[model samples]
Target: MGTLYYGDAASPIEIEDRALAHVKVVIATKLRRGESFTLSWAHGEGQEPGRSTVWLHPSIPLRFAFTEAEPALLSRAWIEELATSANSSGGLMIVPEPERGGETGPR
Candidate 1:
């Protein structure tokens, strides 16, 4: 089993996977651009709160360990949801999307 971390709630927010190629791609790109953000996960049955600030960088290797690492990139759907929530709070972070035209783009 892999490690799972929760946000400020008692729900899991992070999961480890050996097959995290796509996720690593997105996260690497963001880190290359020097972006910092926070990722939260719920701990326990929605009773404990957990959170982590991800300091993205190119030097960080993409691997699954027994401890907390930098925050992983969220799925497109999650990103959209976060954007919406940020808007409601009168603030937001703009995360660029991966190129989809089958063209070689910055990694």
Candidate 2:
């Protein structure tokens, strides 16, 4: 059981095989560009709070143990669901996908 330490609290987040891919892509992109950020989530109603300032690095392997369980990406529909959830959840700390077709700024 891998542990996700957030803020001053810690919990074990279950990561399935599929979700690991998205996590790897997100983390790798941020680390590759020498960016650092925080991932925060409220585990329960009034827990001690949860957050982690991950210092992503390129050498980090895309392994299950290093990723968090975000089951929202199980399918295309789920991906769209997650996108909506992320936007509503104050936006997650992820490397923004590059703009396309002359679009400017981060997506």
Please name the candidate that would achieve the greatest TM-score relative to the true structure.
2
> Backbone collision count in every prediction?
8, 2
Residue 51 error, candidate 2, Å? 8.0
Q: How accurate is candidate 1 locally (lDDT)?
A: 0.39
lDDT (Cα, tens digit) per residue for candidate 1, span 1-107: 24433223453334444213233444444556765333333343544565343433345434433343444333555344444533343223233344333333222
Tens-digit per-residue lDDT, 18-44, candidate 2: 443444444445556865443433343
TM-score of candidate 2 on Cα atoms, chains taken together? 0.35
| Candidate 2 weakest lDDT stretch, 10 residues | 98-107
What TM-score fits each model?
0.32, 0.35
Clashing pairs in 1: 6-41, 6-42, 7-40, 7-41, 7-42, 9-42, 10-46, 11-42
**Which candidate has the top score in lDDT?**
2
- The C-alpha local distance difference test score for the whole of candidate 2 amounts to 0.40
